[model samples]
Every structure is written in C-alpha cells, then in structure tokens.
Target: MDAATLLARLATVIDAHDWAGLPDLLHRDFTCRLVHTGEVFDRDGWVRLNADYPGFQRMHVEGLVADGDHGALRARVIGTSETGAELEFAVASFATVRDGLLAELVEVWADVGQDAPAGTRPQLT
Candidate 1:
C-alpha cells in the first residue's frame, strides 16, 4: 500500500481495536519511539503497548500529511477511567515507510486543552 493509504488504515485499525490488523501495516523490522518517554519498541512490543494501555477507548486522526515514503499525523486519543472520568491526549507522530510497510515511527504525546504557560504569548484580540 502507498504511504498515505497505509497511514490512514493504521488509524482505522487502532480505533477499531483490531490488534490483528496492525501487524499487516508494519514492516518486519518496524520500530516505534515514544519521544516523551524516551522508550522504543519493535513491532511486537509496540502492538503490545497499545493493546495493553489502560482505559484506551478510541483514537481519532485529526490531520495527516504525506510525501513520498514519509508521513506525519496528529491524532486524539480518548479514554474513560474506572471512575468514569474522560481523558484525552493529542499525539503527534512521524512515520517512515519502507517496502510499502511502516518501518519507523516517532511519537510525542501531550494532554489536550492545556493552558499556555504564563507570559508565553499575549491573549488573542
């Protein structure tokens, strides 16, 4: 599959909680880096991490851009805790495709709706 199509499908499978379909879009040597945590995982490890994430409900792709074999995407992940509180995170990912499969991915995640740091910028008019 082309890079864009593969990435689009990636989000779909994850949102659907179809763990079995994830590996099909990954290369044999696939690697994923969690930029915020400084952790890295291979295909199996990455899949396991996502599958085991606590309270994971669904993932929604907010935006995507692709060029050649490289693509970048921003997605929102939502979950509900045991206490019934909703949580949301914004995840930004950069991915490289090799031989029509995802070879490498680097992701940075942050909580959504965080306020800007004090004095970082003036309020909008």
Candidate 2:
C-alpha cells in the first residue's frame, strides 16, 4: 500500500477504536510521540492510551502531504467524553513508512475551544 492509503486506513482504524486492527498497520517496534505531552509510546503503549479514552466520535482528515517515504496528515477530531461533555482537537501527524507499514508516527495535537470554529485562528492579546 502507498503512504496515503496506509494513512487513510490508519485513520479508519482509529475512528473505529479497533485496537485489534492497529497491529496490522503498525510495525512491531513502532514508536509514537505525543507532541503535546512530549511523551513517547511504543505500539503497546499507544493501544493502552486509546483504551482509556474510548469515546472518540468523529475524525476528519483535513489534509495530507507526502514526500518520498514520509508523510504528514492534518486531522480534526470531535468527540464527547464518557461523561457526555463535548471536546474537539486538531492534530498534525508526521509518519514514516517502510515497506508499506507505519514505522513511526509523531503527532502534535491541541484542544480546540468549544466556541472556536474548526480551523479558526486563535486570537492573541
């Protein structure tokens, strides 16, 4: 599969919260960086984190760019917590693919304010 196709599949798997499907897309030693928290996670760790936040409702892939064996995707995620409170975030992910599997993923994400539009620019004071 091409990088774009793999990325789309990854998004689909994540949207479905199908933890079992993740291994098919990731390398056995896959590494991920959470840009906001500056934390690094291995494949197993990634699955564990998602298990804790299983309420993701919607994910929109806004853009994708590829160069050689590397690519990036921008996505908007909207969801409600287990308690029913709404939440939204924008995520930019950089990935490296080798032989059609995702070997690494570095993602930066931020919480979007409830009153803000999906891609609105933040106001600075």
Candidate 3:
C-alpha cells in the first residue's frame, strides 16, 4: 500500500477499535516512540498499551500528510472520565513506512484542556 492508503486505513482501524486489524498495517518490527513518556514499545506491546488507556472515547485523525515512505499525522483525542468530565488532547506523530507498512512511529502528545460545548476537537492554529 502507498503511504496515504496505509495511513487512511490506520485511521479507520483506530476509530473503529479494530485491534486485531491494527498489526496488519504495521511491520512486524514496528516500534512506537512516545515522547511524553520517553519510552518506546513494540507492535504487540503498543496495542496492549492503547487497550488499557483510561477512559478513551475516540481518536480523530484530523490531517495526514505523506510523501514517499514518510508521513505525519495531526490528531485529536477525547475521553470521558467516570465523573462525566471530558478531556481533550492534541497529538502529532511522524511515521516511517517500510515494505508498505508502518515501521516506526514517533509521537508527541499533550492534554490540551477540557472540552467546551462545541466539542473536544483540537483547535489547529
């Protein structure tokens, strides 16, 4: 698959919570680096981490740009706690594709703030 197609499928799989299909879009040696935690995880480990994410409601990939074997994604994520309070996050990741699958992903993320009435979508500026 091309960069765009692979990324689009990734977005779809994430939003749909298709955990089983996620590995199909990634290389067997896939590694994800989380800048916030200064840590990296292998494919299976990464999937497990996301599965345990607290109060995750949705992940919206707002924009993706790719060329050759590299891609960048701008995304927003929203979650609701038991108290019914909503939280928003701004996420950015740079990815490297190899053999038509994601080989590496480096991500930066931040808890932007609570969501307003309009929505929890990240404000891109």
Best by TM-score: 1
List ranges where model 2 is wrong by over 4 Å: 114-125
For residues 18-120, write the lDDT of model 2, one tens digit per residue: 8888888888888999978899999888877875676678778999988767889999998888798988999999999987888899999988865666568
Q: What lDDT score goes with residue 5 in model 2? A: 77
Question: What does candidate 3's lDDT look like per residue over 64-93, in tens digits?
Answer: 999989988888989888898998898898
Candidate 3: where is the Cα deviation over 4 Å? 114-125
**Candidate 1 residue-wise lDDT, 1-125, digit = tens:** 76788888999999999998899999999999999999999999999998998899999999999998999989999998889899999998899999999999999999988888999998898
RMSD of 1: 1.4
Per-prediction TM-score to the true structure, in the order listed:
0.93, 0.83, 0.85
Model 1 TM-score relative to the real fold = 0.93
lDDT of model 1 at residue 51? Answer: 90
Better of 1 and 2 by TM-score: 1
Model 3's alpha-carbon lDDT is 0.87
Model 3, position 104, has a per-residue lDDT of 93
lDDT (0 to 1) per candidate: 0.93, 0.85, 0.87
Q: Which consecutive 10 residues in model 1 have the weakest lDDT in total? A: 1-10
